[model samples]
Target: MEQLLYITIGGSTHTATMVSNAATEALLTRLKSSPVTVTLNSSGGFEIWGALGFSLPATDEPVNAQPGDIVLYNGSNICMFYGTNSWSYTRLGKIDGLSESELRTFLKAGESNVKVTLSLSNTAGLQSVDGSVAKSNGSAYTLSGTSACAGQKGVCIKNKKKIIR
Candidate 1:
């Protein structure tokens, strides 16, 4: 099943969905525990990090990504963008109904760092993952120790692929 992820940053909440795959499965499973909070900052045209220490499928990498695209970067980072990027990114979902300028305003809420809360939403859609079908739900988690990763640009892997959150 395709599920929605609610990202609350500052005063705005954006919704996104995941592409069906084992990687996405692993991520959804972690989400059931609680919503994951990650410290994020603006970089280039996107807000990167809030690394949930969650891993997912590095499946499809779109040649280019537009605003409101939620993507898995480097297999560990969940990146939401307000601008365009070209890379092999496993697309999680896109934020619906936000105009381009509105998205930029949301992402650029601040220049330093901002905290984002991610939780599974009530809406769902039909999708496939590893040839299996099951219903899944989620909310948020802790971001108590990832302040160190907040100021940096791009996803930084620690201890050989660990996000160190």
Candidate 2:
């Protein structure tokens, strides 16, 4: 199933989809309640690999990564890309709704050592409170849609255990 991950940098938050795999699931499990923080570094001659740092305490050798992509480097580090890289990396997720330029700008904001966050978004269809995806009615759920969360099949805000499918 597709999973939604929120990437917050400073004040701006970007939406991303976690790739289906052992590493992704493990990462999510670690981040189920709280997010992990790490320093993001700006790299490459043209800053194509912006915010290209952080470690997740998990690892898997996957192969490679590209622009707008998030990956696990050597098993425990989270690498967000503004440019492409050839290496053994497990993909974490891909940020949505941002152009190449927009992504580059956001990632390269500080040029070095920027902080980023990864959190779970209920739209990931993690299953209802009873471990089922059945529709939970009432104000517990709302359809507050946004460009970042486009093509959503359902939406549930923070502090509420509700899902619309």
Clashing residue pairs in all predictions, respectively, total 9, 4
lDDT of every model, 2 decimals = 0.61, 0.61
Evaluate model 2: give its TM-score: 0.64
For candidate 1, what is the TM-score? 0.65
Off by over 4 Å in 1: 60-62, 122-165
List pairs with backbone clashes in candidate 2: 55-77, 56-76, 58-75, 59-75
Query: TM-score for all predictions?
Result: 0.65, 0.64
Question: Which candidate ranks first by lDDT, i.e. highest?
Answer: 1
User: In candidate 2, what are the lDDT values of residues 18-125, reduced to their tens digit?
Assistant: 888877887788778676656777766223232334334454675556668887766655677777667776777888878777888767633777777667752332
RMSD of each: 16.0, 8.4
